[model samples]
Target: MKNILVLCTGNSCRSQIAHGYINHFLKGRNVAVYSAGIETHGINPGAAAIMKEDGISIDHHTSNHVDEYSHINFDYIITVCDHANENCPYIPSKNALRLHHNFYDPSKLEGTEDEKHTAFLKAREEIKAYFKDFVSEYFRG
Candidate 1:
């Protein structure tokens, strides 16, 4: 089994979005996807709502701290935001391949409901595209 961890400043948004997409894309494959943050900010409601729009459900996902998975050796450690990438703690996984991409935080936007929704929609699509390419390249069967 392959283990992958997604990291972010807060596991609430971008990391959670990536987690959902990785799981969706790798379903039935021998892969386990986990996401965490430098600080737990709880799962973002906007992230869940946006994922649901694409027929992916992340409602059951939770915000978690990076230390929680210290024991598990991850095959990939992915940082989804600049903050987490730069500030990421050292994971003891000897061979974990690290990947980083700074996705814009849609949750930080303060705007009218429609605008906020649009922001989330855009982020979701970008994340979705990224992970789709990632899965194809790394998990091709």
Candidate 2:
């Protein structure tokens, strides 16, 4: 099994979005998907809403700290934030792979509600596209 962890500063936005997409697309195909953060600062409503636009439900996902998976093994530890890439702990010798995928926090944009949601939606789509390409390159049969 290919165990992959999508990591971010908070397990709320980018990591959660990537988790939803990977779980939707890579089911029953030997790839396991999970996401975590340096700090579990609750789920981002914007991420949940944008993913809903694509028929994927990530609303129920709770924010999770990386310590949640300390007992498990990960084949890929992908950081969706600059902070996570720099501050990760306990990397396994055999299955450790680090990737830097910096994504803006759409929830942090200062704008009208619609404008903020637009940013979230745009980030969601780009993350999905890049993730699809990454999956095709690494995990496709």
Candidate 3:
């Protein structure tokens, strides 16, 4: 089995969404997906709500700091936000492939409920598309 880490600044929105999609796509497969942040900002309610709309539940996922998984070796370390990519800590996984994608941060969007929902939806779709392709190209047999 291969272990994958999705990272972000808060682990509340973008990373959590990616984690959900990766797990959903890789179900019954050999990949184990985890998400963490530079600093735990708690799970974003907007993130959970948006994912639930897509039939994926991330409500039970917890916000975690990168150090929480220091003992495990990761096959891939992916940064879902620029902040995370810039400030990521030194991971000890010698052979881990590091990848970065600057996904839109819905948590930073401020406005009416509809606007926020739209932002979340946009990010969710982007994450879903990216991870779907990732799983197909890299993990699918």
Candidate maximizing TM-score: 1
lDDT, candidate 3, 1-141, per-residue tens: 899999999899999999999999989988788999999999999999999999999988999999999998999999999999999999999799999999988899889999999999999999999999988888857
Of models 2 and 3, which has the larger lDDT?
3
lDDT of 2 at 103: 82
Task: Score residue 70 of candidate 2 by CA lDDT.
Answer: 79
Residue 137 lDDT (model 3): 84
- How many backbone clashes are present in model 1? 0
Query: Residue by residue across 78-100, what tens digits does model 2's lDDT show?
Result: 88888888887765537567677
The local lDDT score (0 to 100) that residue 105 gets in candidate 1 is 97
Q: Which stretches of candidate 1 lie over 4 Å from their true place?
A: none
On lDDT, who's better, 1 or 3? 1
For model 3 the TM-score comes to: 0.98
Residue 83, candidate 3: Cα error in Å is: 0.8
- On TM-score, who's better, 2 or 3? 3
| Alpha-carbon local distance difference test for all models | 0.95, 0.86, 0.94
In candidate 2, which residue pairs get closer than 3 Å at backbone N, Cα or C atoms, i.e. clash?
none
Candidate with top lDDT is 1
Ranking by lDDT: 1, 3, 2
Worst 10 residues of 2 by lDDT: 90-99
